[model samples]
Target: MARFRLLADEHQARSPLRQLWREFARQHSAVAGLALFSAFFVLAIIAPLLTPHAPYLQNDNLLLLPPSWSELGLVQYPFGTDDLGRDMFSRFLVGTRYTFGIAVITVLGALIAGLLLGTLAGMSRGVKSSVFNHILDLALTIPSLLLAIIIVAILGPGLLNTIWAIMLALLPQFVHGVRNAIAEQLNQDYVIAYRLDGANNLQVFRRIILPNIWERLTVTATMALSTAILDIAALGFLGLGAQAPTAEWGAIIADSLDLIYVAPIGVALPGLLIFLAVLSVNLVGDGLRTAVKKRREN
Candidate 1:
């Protein structure tokens, strides 16, 4: 009887997750976006094996060479070399690691921090909640990119500083979002019933609030991820994020600006990669929102 009950409990635990996956899979754009992002992640993991040359290795012989298919191109240099004779393809693969790594770190940091602070504010009485919301609103009044830039400037230029700056800039959005979502859930009839039935705050949050608000949280995280990627690239372009010799997508474009007339592909390739990453992320975010809405309606 004990073993059977455990099995039943496990199945019950898995049911909602399974249903969520089914709903998410029904969105074709989400699937495509997930697949493309997964490919980028896989390539990032196996970058050493895929890269023909080191990202920073200068090859004088291959300077300004176009892609392999182009006229006068070499097969060894699949995506050709930049003005500095470094392999574009290798840099791209390696850059994916940095770009994705920073974005993931900042997003997770902001999300976790936001969840904690938001919960506190949401569960608080009138005065505390008002104060928290006021602070958040003040932060939000400054555009995220501008706020990040200001923070980066104060901290000085570097990848680590950029991550911190971006994380801070993004925190207000998450906190505000989570707070409102939590507040709304708290006012729901089911939540009140749970509370009236002698459930503690933690119990109510875990069983009622979290399950209800997680879909919105997932969508917010996805959207923030895309924004982080774009901001990272933008900062790198402005010489405030990834520095010289770093195989970052934005830095690649920044370094290749001088070569635009001579080696147009160098600038074009990294820009294209940035565009695709943001687009895929946005598609996934939109798809998730749509899926969740449809699920709720059904």
Candidate 2:
């Protein structure tokens, strides 16, 4: 059976995607995390239909209502009502859009910008590379949230500004990682051999470098996504991100601070969602990193 399994693995190794999937599937926690993340993503998409009431609708009578399962709760409000009498469940559903949505947009923007800048830095020489590395190092020295705060301070508070701030804050890591990855690949014998074999820069990059470094890129992206989510929420909490009527998770938590004693669950639920989303993304990243390492070793 071991011999057969080895033969099967060898066959799968011919296809990197299949081998990656097989390795990733072996991680139960990662699979669970992927499922959880997918659920949140889907909910964010369908939140408008799933919400029991208008997320912004307010009723003084329902203010601070407990969860449906609680004694003082109503069946109509599963997650209860906020201090403003808006349905907590509805706000949560809508909030998912802001949290995940903004994170996705920020990460993608950073990834694209990084790929372009990192490629240029990696392919350049002397002064260009030095300048790029120095800039990245300077940015890295500042904490992401602090960098975002500085940016938001300049741009003024709002969801759009927060997105730009977080994207800018997250850009350096991707740029540095991609630059290092490409530089490392360029130093390898395979790249040198390809160049000698009449391959142009574009051909070598498309055929050899990208394939070799994609797993690392995937891991970095997953991790960055969680970071973006946290950063967005943090900015929102500080009043430098999504503002009132936005239903963003962090803003929701901020609004609930005054009513924490009366409606502790309001804060707890959004906080829990953020925790879960970050945990899920981290788990996926860990699993991908492990799979990539194992694949390389074998």
TM-scores of the models, in the order given: 0.91, 0.95
lDDT of 2: 0.91
Spell out the clash pairs found in candidate 1. Answer: none
Candidate achieving the largest lDDT = 2
Per-model tally of clashing residue pairs: 0, 0
lDDT of 2 at 125: 94
Tens-place lDDT digits, model 2, residues 1-298: 9999999887877787887888889999999999988888897788899888999999999888999999999999998998889999999999999998789889999998988888888878998789879988999999899999999999999999999999999999999999999999999998999999999988988899888888888899999999999999998888899999899999999999889999998789899999999998998899899888887776
Minimal lDDT window, size 10, model 2: 10-19
* Model 2 ranges with Cα > 4 A deviation: 1-10
Candidate 1, residue 75: how far the Cα is off, in Å: 0.8
How much lDDT does each candidate structure score?
A: 0.88, 0.91
Q: Write the per-residue lDDT of candidate 1 for residues 1-298, one digit (tens) a residue.
A: 9999999987864676666677889888899998987777676677778787889999777788888999888898888888778888889989987787678789999999999998998888888788878988999899889999999999999999999999999999999999999999999999999899999999988899988889899999999999899899999999999999999989988899987998887789889988888888888898888878776765
